[model samples]
Target chain A: MLLPWEYGVRNLARRPLRTMLTLAALSTVILLVFVVVGFIRGLEKSLSISGDRDVVLVYSVNSEENIENSAIAARTPALLAASVEGTQQRFGVTHVSPEMYLGTRVNTDENNGGLGLVRGVTTGAPLVRRSVKLIDGKWPSSGEVIVGQLAAAKLGYDKQDLAIGKQVVFENKTWEIVGQFAAGGAACESEIWCNLADLQTATKRQDLTVVALLLEPGSSTAEIELFCKERTDLELRALGETDYYQSLQQHYKPVRILAWLVVLLVSGAGVFAGLNMMYGAVAGRVREIATLQAIGYRRRAILLSIVQEGVLLAAAASLIAGAIALVLMNGLAIRFTMGAFTLRIDSVAVLFGCGIGLLLGVLGALPPAIKALRAKVAVSLKAV
Target chain B: MKTIANLSLVTAIVVLIGCKPSESKNENTKSSEPTGKQYLVASEPDDSTPVGEARKGAKDGDAVTLVGHIGGSTKPFVEGIAAFTIVDPKVAYCPPEEGCPTPWDYCCTQNEVKENIATVKIVNERGKTVSEDARQLLGVKELSLVVVQGTAKRDEQGNLSVMAQKVYVKQ
Candidate 1:
């Protein structure tokens, strides 16, 4: 016969201080699991949602992977719009955008400055980057700029510091923040965007960084690549936007592996902590366990009761940690090399965190409970 | 209650493992079998201009035979099409000590590559480029020396391309 469930629950209350300390320790470990898992999810989501399969990026062949280092002729966009068949078009306008991208020091004030991603784009940018939505104010004109929703967090500044009409200094020119935009949590949300002509004037550049164009439903990326091949003088390379972002995901594989390793290391450490605490708890209860065994309880029944106590404590800790993570870390914007993304405390993270907690409870209880039950019932009962 | 908790624990383990990002799948449409065997010649043309000289002199619709190593960019062959870029043989590959992973790209002489590379496409009677992959059609890979006999097509930008009628792959 099994021990009564109330027996396990009552044992938790018998030693209040030790129980509370164990709960706190378990909660802290589960919270760390929530954070690391959230980070991995956020980074993955940002990259996955950033690309549109129909859009293609045309940049200089020499630039290879880094779009910021790419330079193409200013007329390349016009040429591609005219030459490439099956491009999306409506009302005599083509879905092509010429952009200049760079990383530069952006200063909200004299004291607050950091490396910031900036993109200079034409009106046609919205045509190609369909995910981008202007959330506030109007589009930028000369000497004006627009900040992305997460740009403030990326630049380590308060939202008010980059509010509409506030000035930011970059490229040795002060630009008034005229608008705010969001790109469905894509990396662009961590950049500042401005007028292409204005940025060109400021940076003293005539070349473009890239030309992005959208293709019709049945269109293939091979056609655009063929155009690049045929016009070798242009020195351009075409890549599907989805493939481009997928490549970025591949580039960050090492970081994700390192994150998983951290999760393993943290879980390992938590297991050790749980074992140490359970050993102390079980050592104190040996005589009680012996008394129960003497009163016709099997060793299996006593062990189950001990495990039940541990699992109960862990379940409570999981709830506490999940609540704290949801409140404090969910949607918290964090800066990365590409840009910034929010920590996502979604259902997956919650499930993973709680799973770790329960696993800890089971694993932590087994060895100590087995050790205690192994002693002779007579010797245990006669112990001081 | 114990049974329920065990079940939930198993469910959580399955769900957490399933939480990984789904890999993006590439969709490729296989074209009909190509019948361009006549274009793949058995003998190399004796009078062939170097790809560098052909780029400067070849005109639209002019019959030409050009000889060069099959490479200019990292991906010399276009996907899903019987087309590839050939660079002038005179452009030397980077030495092994340079640690260049793709010497066929001629990264050390990019400017010369820009001037000497010519796109070769095998076209059907409809004047459309063949739908088959070049590697499968020509049996030639990157940096393979070959002779291409085709009609030159020059764009306004002075870029040269060949609508290939025949190709001789050097074994």
Candidate 2:
């Protein structure tokens, strides 16, 4: 084993040109794999943070952006909540918050104007969504509004300006700034919150737009969906947060899928380059490798040593790429048609990159290692 | 006592017959008057003017039926779509999502049964008459239509952009 590794090291070191080329090819592929995997995982995590595994997003079965568009007859929430006994299995009415939603404009009491989604929430909604944090100020009173942390920044309002007594306006209606809250780092940080009543009055939507339900813990997504399906009158649908994000991930699906395709193509190119480079290295290193085998090193041992070099090169590149992504990509928001979301960088993305690199290293090293091991000792010695 | 009951029944029948006009619930049952045939053609969006001159053409200061989304259609159709359909049923939100109408680039609504070209009317789950709020907040009333009036238009894609003016419910 030691003999083979010593030979492998000496052989790789002797053919500097070939070894460099192979390492370059392997490292480039490994680095790219690291970045792409991490990006997808990070984004998925950020999106998932906003959804509960059991919460169903009941939207117009017509309205794309407005609740008023496909107004579910206001009757649905209650019926779905209590209509069937089995629907609300353990603790009846675990959580139901009927709401009205609209994407509209809001002016921060600050200088620059801010435009974003103004969500009308009922008092009970906060209970259903416990992630909401009251950072400062009080709960929104009637005709009062609460701004998100980032929302405050967008409005040109400093954190100090988001005081409990500040005033904000929307749709020509003056709403007293009541309180502020943050939902960790999820997407909810970009909304203007007000009482459902005030939103109704301002938007002239006396009709509520959406019904959100947080199911009792421990219920499987299939079971919940089955229950929603059974009720015709209720006309409700349930999706796990992961499934919902995946469905919405359809928006980012192209990027995610394209990243893999890009990686695969690039990796293929790298593999070709590495194969040529490794073949040259194997041919050039015939003497050293043959000497090691002649001195009693097993073919498997030599193979393992060469493979280790490839793996180490790839892993190093992955670590470097993952670090770069963490530093540069984190919190960088990508603008979409109606809004923007920042990249969520986490430990998961880094680990994913490492895993990709490890796979690449193993796969990339195999062929060249085998070819070198198969070289006949007598011919290799004679050539050298 | 029996004679009094008999008198009350006769009076009640007479009153019911007299006040039937006030209790008429049907909107599309047709009026008794002679009028031009107004087809409930899918709420058409007309965009002959430039953006500077374009607006959700209101009829004599009244809300126009910008579009309608009927409920439970196998083929998804939002009213006033002359051409083009959203490839993905998601809306890109400008802001991070929060509260009830979490910000999204696009999203689907589950309000009232979409009744394309039907007059916008809101009804409760139990089929009762209630305020739009009681229905909206309670998730009882399905939106019959989403009507927008005098809103701006964006024709970036060369399709006529119609903002919702008033949602109509086909009663």
Candidate 3:
């Protein structure tokens, strides 16, 4: 007689200790996969969400967006506005914000300080980079500054460090903290923003570092290229905001690949550990299997029963691991050289975890199951 | 044993939680103040053209003289090098009535700040930073009017810059 599905389900409970060890190992592997994949996805999401596809970023020729190395003439923005075609205008004003980007030290206390990226921005800043939204206080002016929600934490500060009405020193000037902003988990959340001229004077860099432009709808990249060619005086190179971040994402490809390698190696260990547990279980259940076969259950039926138990254990463990990852890893701040991005453990990540768990159960049970079925019925029944 | 499984679970959880993210480890140790020393200052700068006009028509290799007030920083060249930004006096600054916080520059709430500025770097015959020549214009306070005479050169990248030969500042 064919054994009922309940028989397979109850078999895992027979060896509680071995089953728990195997489940624990598999669950750990699922957690590892979740973290690795989540990290890469988080970085990509942060960059993509932060930049608008319709905008273009113009930097000095042969330079990155870094302010220390790239020196642009102050007149370039007006020159580009008059020269470049397809630039969007808002309320009779051209949508152009010439900005300065720099990484400088920010004082956490009277005696201690840490590195922070500061953006020198004008009134058009909010229009150009629309992702930034002031959440706590007013926009910064003159000697006042606003910090991103993640900036304080990245600078080794606690919650109270960037509270409004506080003071922190930068550029050798005492800047009163006036506001805090959120950028929807964008990289801008790891920076400080202040008045354009204040930062320029403070850094002794009077020139604008880069010009960000909002292009009119239906504008093409050729327009930007033609603008750069016609105005040789500007000495500028234009990149779509999306392209700029795509290149940044490419820069971190190696790190993401390394994370996958780690997942593979760690999961390999889990698979082998699982295989060992199944081997022991099948050996101890050899007589039980022969008795089932003698009662007219086929070898295929016995094999299916063994594999089902392995998969069921993995599924149960996967649920536990998924819950744990959601609580601890989701929305966790992960800092990098440019800024910090949050780890997101969404439904997609959970589905990936479950898929890997299912694969482990199938592969880990196969060899042991085949070995158990190849045993002769009469000899297997008499063996142990 | 169940204890072994529990121990393994606890270890993995602890390890995952302990791997906290952090900012860049490369710390900036430089002081907040712009670094460098005072250069020489000059009294009674000579005949000059407005900085905005000088920037408009001056061709590459043309000997040009520009008169403008410093707009950005009051600090002397950090390395005693003769390089600074100058702005046209015609540009509007914050009036006392506006209660402007940054009186140093006109960019606080106004538009068109960039159209009035130029960079002046003084270099010797060897085309290197001339600390001696820079001294003649060093320590000149920000917003003080000055005259710079230099050979206008378009850099290989086509950016306009001045290789100043003489820089004079008003007392």
Candidate 4:
């Protein structure tokens, strides 16, 4: 009887075309699974980094994203400051900053047709959050505005762009571009900064909009929430800064779920391909497997050897897929809305994909591997 | 391109190191980062504290104290507690059918009076309803003995009105 390794080699050698086709098909499926996982990983990192851990984002209760839609009457910041029990704020524990989320069109004397998230903020904002960096010019004054990194790129504005100092007109009101900044790699990069009061006038909104605040030491979100409940006229929700961003993920859920659905469908196709190839490979190799059995090969040994070959083939294909994803997909930035983040092909995700592939290979190939061994030795020899 | 990548990597590390300190420091002191000193937990929670009562010491340019969140998107409600200025003797009126209410133009709803604050409804001596700016005139009497603050804007009609920022009950 041939040794176990000898039987595997002879079976694979006999159907070179089928073997190559199965490996290639499996490799493509693994590649797709890796890409989807990579995108999700990159997106999570981008969000956690974009909103600084130090800053608190206040939105109206029951409102998840689009704080413009989450407007708390301009007074919420201070009321929360006074009501949340056990919060520590000293030397003005409350830094009340109003924010307006207005996405509108603006231009430089022409239809530049650029989209912007114009945030109307007060001077107190600079003290509350430290992540907003002004690398050029100065902080926006009452009539002036600051541009985000992405906004600057879209407007062709540089650090020395004196056009910021010059009065530019839009929607009948004149505003000076005073400064530019980068808020990490977050969605804020598409934002425009202006004074809360001035923007109210420019937009003709006399009524105040939502407000944000920073709490000092010894503060808890639960106390603020309880305080909000007592003031039922104003619905309030207080959550930690990290917890808030996690909630923002719900904004991206519909699309992310669609992605996961696509991956599930594609992985089904891979399993189908795997089962078909495994059955065919076993059927075609019955003569060889029976011949080994004819020579006193144990049934368990025959089945185990065939299963190993199947897994090794899938693993090799998966490794190739991993290498491809790492080289071509890394740092491929996706422009989602006004902001963009790179698709990072993380190593841990590669291991996860390959592990899935190995599981599929074992489950799909085992039945076929056992069936071929179950065939009678005399019948197998006669066909050969 | 490679240099940009390297620079970004360094920056990320620096930022990472920077954020850890405050979290760790807070964790060490409070045994939890959730509560400590920034917020004053009331010895007993008081539902009677009008949002303004709790926030009497807020400095300039902060959000006015609100009883609760406004329910809708950008729903504009002149917060009664944060009135920037108070104007009294608003031209309130009883219904025109009520014989013009003896010539006082300002009147209060039962709900308003129960809250110890009346929403000022303004009407001319002839009993014509006016803009909400007239509502501020109602709070003037309520806060004359205390302090109230907010921004003031001229309405379509020229009138001095208060956008109440705060209302304090003076002892």
Clashes of each: 0, 67, 4, 38
What are the candidates' interface root-mean-square deviations? 6.3, 29.6, 12.0, 16.4
Candidate 2's TM-score reads 0.51
Candidate 2: lDDT of A255?
A: 70
- For candidate 1, the TM-score of chain A alone relative to the native chain A: 0.98
Write candidate 2's Cα lDDT for A1-384 as tens digits. 454345545656676776666666665665566555655665565566877666655655345333335566566666666643223333433466778766666665564465566778876677666678988888888888887755654443465665678777787798887778787755567677888877777777666677776665654444334333333233345445455555666666667666766655565555555555655656666787788788898887777777776666566666666676778766655433323445655676566566766666665677767766777889877774
**Model 1 Cα lDDT, one tens digit per residue, A1-384:** 999999899888988998899899989988999999999999999999989999999999989888999999999999998888989998888999999999898998643677889999999999999999999999999999999999988887888889997999999999999999999899999999999999999999999999999998988888899999999888899999988899999999979877876776677667766777788888998899899998999989988988888888888989999999999999999999899999999988999999998988887787789888989988998888
Which residue segments of model 2 deviate by more than 4 Å? A1-31, A46-49, A53-59, A63-69, A73-96, A104-115, A141-180, A184-190, A197-204, A213-263, A266-287, A290-299, A322-351, A370-384, B1-171
lDDT of 1 by residue, B1-171 (tens): 243356447655754675566653322222233356777887878889999998788888899999898889877888878888998889887876766667778888887787888999988767789887887777777777889988899988888899887888774
True lDDT of residue A37, candidate 3: 72
Error of 1 at B135 (Å): 3.3
Question: How do all models score by TM-score?
Answer: 0.89, 0.51, 0.67, 0.56
Candidate 4 lDDT at A220 equals 40
lDDT of 3 by residue, A1-384 (tens): 456899988889889988888888888888888887788778778878867888888777537444345678888889788877788897899989899888778885643667888888998888888888999899988899998988875676775877899888888878889999999988889898899999889878778878888888887544564355334456566778887788777777668766766766666666677688888999998899899898898888888888898888878877878888899999887777777888888777788777877877876787788888888998999986
Task: Please give me the DockQ of candidate 4 compared with the native complex.
Answer: 0.02
What ordering of candidates by TM-score runs from best to worst? 1, 3, 4, 2
lDDT of 4 by residue, A1-384 (tens): 325576666666678898889889989988888888777776776677765444556566546455556766766766666655454455754565667767676666543655546778887767665567887778877788887766644444442432456555544577898887776756566567888888878877754445555655544443344344334355544455666667678667666766766666566667667777888887877887787787788888888777777787788778888888889987565556535555777876677678767866775577677667667788888775
Which scores greater on TM-score, model 2 or model 4? Answer: 4
lDDT of 3: 0.72
